[model samples]
Target: MLYQDALLERLESGLRKSLPQWGLPQDAKVSLLEISENATYLAEDGNGEKTIFRVHRPDYHTEEEIRSELAWVAALREDGVVETPRTIPTEDGSPLSSFSDGEATRYIAAFSFMSGKEPDAEDDLVKWYGELGEINARLHTHAREWQKPEGFTRKTWNFDTIIGDGALWGEWSAAPGLTEEGHAILEKTAALLRKQTDAFGAGEDRFGLIHCDMRPANLLVDGDRLGVIDFDDCGFSWYAYDFAAAVSFLEHEPYLPDLMAAWVEGYRKQAPLSDEIAAALPMFVMLRRMQLTAWIASHGETETAKSMGVPYTEGSVALGETYLAENG
Candidate 1:
């Protein structure tokens, strides 16, 4: 409820006192530029230096887990697989910092900013499918080093758990955009979930530290190369789920399968995906779509979110209907 600014003041003061390991002067002029529920940013300094200040929700991730994540990112950079913001350390060189909030909450640390161009949003946009694959290959290959944190459950990212939380399915299924085809999608997926409950949770799905939310928005394409950012959602998940998420939001972009294949081939080169994971992708894709729409429907308040989402929400519902009809 303090909004992003109040959180930033506390985060900046901490950064000023901490994070010399990031190679910044103690008194470096820092400015807050980007702030989200899980991240805060300091604008470009006169020397063009910038760093992302972050605070992961403690309800979901622990402080120690966050520290391990940064350490892993630093290690990945050393491996030359992918690019991540360099983690800056506190004066004592610890990566974790805290503002001493209630036991359930804590303010975390910061990292140097990585770079990328904004993805083209226009209709002519060529979704960088193959490049996305290569990037994911590097990400998965690099993520294998970090030990998973405790109580960090693995998410299979299928049709059930994503929107099958019971609380959501009823309303989500009844949302305004349910095309007749969409109804079939829900019905068929429900049946599949019931038939394959145990199969959905397979451990052979190549679980490791996944980028978790590999959306187009979080990736930067410099020339033919791709750089990733925004690790707020990084965690233990099925590798294909990460790949599914990368291509999920890009349905509006051109050439989706091409992009997906590029990422899949690259990831497979590092660690081959099981047939079960490959077969489960469509359901997971639909599940992710439903879950994201439901997230916006429930939490979206800003004009931009609601306004931009109105069309997306409707489009997704429509897509659901179409998938349902085709599968029927």
Candidate 2:
């Protein structure tokens, strides 16, 4: 589900006016890169320097929240915790800039393009997951120690926030292809998950702010350096949720166990991991799949949701059943 022609035209028109405010030349080349949670565009300046222009979806995040996100990103860069693209400010010196068409307001931000290729899923992803684990460990360490600015606000991905009435995306019951059978299986899985997460508890070490979206698509590889992008979904959650997000849509992959082991090993290289946390990896994976199922149902117009359709929801049910059989 690509954006409608009218919506694309309006966004493009806004970009034409907005680029100059970001200090790009009049002849800058602009094109839509992706239209997922947000509409992202690529702008190439006259000198061939590329910048990513992100047009945030309306009502998802307020200006203060977006600023809070950038504040953490800046802290990560300054502390040398991980490699991330740098945000470029508007002429007015505000990190977040916006324009509204009366119908909807689009908050925009610019980031210098970091050069790298996304890892191929068909190729060896275990090694990539290992690197990602190390990176996530560093980020978690920073999140534990870093001081947040006043008014710092971000959504929490706690159990209730995910499966309850106010689920961040939507309830799993509404996901596509969810028959009575599918719902029953997922509900069981969710109950077990709630029990496990509750037992684990949200102690300072186990739960905190995290990059909730850490899939391969959000990762960039340049030689030995692994760079993470797309902090839009960053917020408070179980730290192991990051590992679950690492394997994201690939939960059903046959090599998942190997990938999980690799991630845990890599993570342990930097931070301490308990056997209890390691034992709960499968639960986290199933939880991530269920969350994605709800996301697909709620965001039916996005290309990912449109393409996933019945197969994705059905797969989630299968995964849920397997998780219950093994973990329940």
Candidate 3:
């Protein structure tokens, strides 16, 4: 059974062998920075050079699924449209490596670290999310050319599971200050989405490889360039959902038509959106909000998460309150 330290040592060994091949120095002493549920480490050479090493979770996928993930990124790189972490093979040139905690661990892969700065909402809000929108555009563009990987299947994004079925609202109604109105909103919103989700199946609206999670945290900005990471959630899905995600998460400035215009402008430079996409953006915003709202509502005071109540449900209610008071 490989322990965490032993697994890391194995990862370091892989990096020591691979980075130099990418033209990194032999004197590189890689400094490991962050490790997510999917393990990644940052290694720095003597010249302060850094690259990311990835350890894929075999529990989450098959070797084919792993191949599909990198292939999607590689396809985009080939098109000269985006920056994907260069996959560094093992000593034998295999794109992925398998190891065990003996407790059933997963497949892991290593990559050359990408460079960039993390954007923040507290500082320059609009610009920060706008940058995220640009990266989303780039990711989905060349991604359209990539072949679907062998072991991969469609991902639900769980939108319907999270908010529909009345069972969903039933599951979260006991939390403090949760009202009948919020529950009703969840039921109604989910119903509306379900009836329309497949309304544009795999057409221009549904086609393309989507970076399912386009949250601001996954992006890196260097000067005017941006890099995106965390593609474990990548899959074939609605192209507009990508826009919906970028628009919602990065809507730092007031949610207005002008800011939406800026995002559309930047996204078009990579892959343009259609009129269908434009019309659905507002509903997508509503859907993402409610999904997060319901998730938080179910797990109030989760030690690691920020809030416990539904976000959009309460938010819209408060906005309504404000509107009514001013008018009445």
Candidate 4:
């Protein structure tokens, strides 16, 4: 469902009308920021206060799931575990507000803006990954120990949910510029990952809820402190997968080994990860690539999809082939 210009304009207009419900003044300005799984807007009030307004794509996330995500984020803030965008409630005291133009129903939520810069891929990635490692550790530690509210639920990033025929992000075969050879190699790579994962097994220490999307895009470099935003994809999965996600689109970077090592070193400072689990890091990387391949295939209109285009899929294939040659 690519949002045509007219559709986006309509949504922005609707958002402006709904602003007052969230305490924004009538003169608040709403502008599109980014579009991925959702259409995000940067809403600024007359006094220059800013907030992020996310209009979720229809049929992707249930109301219950959205509530559950907010609950975990709220808990993280209250516990001082990490700095997440504070979710704002509507006038009715509800976390989510709904809007529909009689065609598609959109769920909207607002959050106080967290300001920071994103780490550049050309920069010292090892240093950035080290900071990310510490951030990932803190989130995982909180996920393991924190008690969930009643009926709390979220998506799962297991093999079945990610690479299976009914994968949430669509099939990798459809990713643009994916060759037959590429698809074949990726299929083999997927099989290998499944086998390794079964062998590694998921013990309580190794699996739990995680911030599944840890790419640089989700990170905000706020001074010396790093702030993580976007819990839309938070779910249960292997703890080591977080490392794979940290290096998500940069798998082909030559300094990948150093980055992974830095992440491991940073993580070990907070909690213990056995060598056996560590050995499966490549499998997680391969898994994350597969998931991204599917995401790109399904989300053709997104800026991420447009920028990466065919080159990203081609790179994934090359990476998959190399991984298989080394480990198969």
Highest lDDT against the true fold, candidate = 2
TM-scores of the models, in the order given: 0.75, 0.96, 0.70, 0.96
Q: How close is candidate 1 to the true structure, as a TM-score?
A: 0.75
lDDT of 1 by residue, 141-237 (tens): 6666545455444333434445675532124564445567655665565555445544667463466667777676777767665677777666666
lDDT-best of 3 and 4:
4
TM-score of 3: 0.70
Clashes of 4: 0
Q: Please, what's the RMSD in Å of model 4? A: 1.4
- Cα deviation at 130, candidate 4, in Å, is 1.4
lDDT tens digits by residue: candidate 4, 64-96: 888999999999999997878999999889999
List model 2 lDDT by residue over 1-328, tens digit each: 3367788888878877888888887568998988888889999987888999999888788888899999999999999998999989988888988888568888998898998988876656888888888888899999999999999999898888877567878888888878999899989998998898788788887899999998888888888778899999899999999998878788998889998999999999999988988888887888888888988988888887889989998999998898888875
lDDT of each: 0.60, 0.87, 0.58, 0.86
| lDDT tens readout by residue for model 3, 1-328 | 1226776676556556555554566457666665433556676766776666666643556677677777766666667666657776656667766655457645656677777766664445466556656766766755665565666554445444435554232243443455887556545555566655656455644466788666655667777766777677676666666755654433323654555666666677666777777666655655555554544454343321233334444664453344334323
Each prediction's total of clashing residue pairs, residues at least 3 apart in sequence or on different chains, is 10, 0, 7, 0
RMSD of each: 4.6, 1.5, 6.1, 1.4
What's model 3's lDDT at 108? 59
Give me the displacement of residue 219 in model 2, in angstroms: 0.6
lDDT of 4 at 23: 90
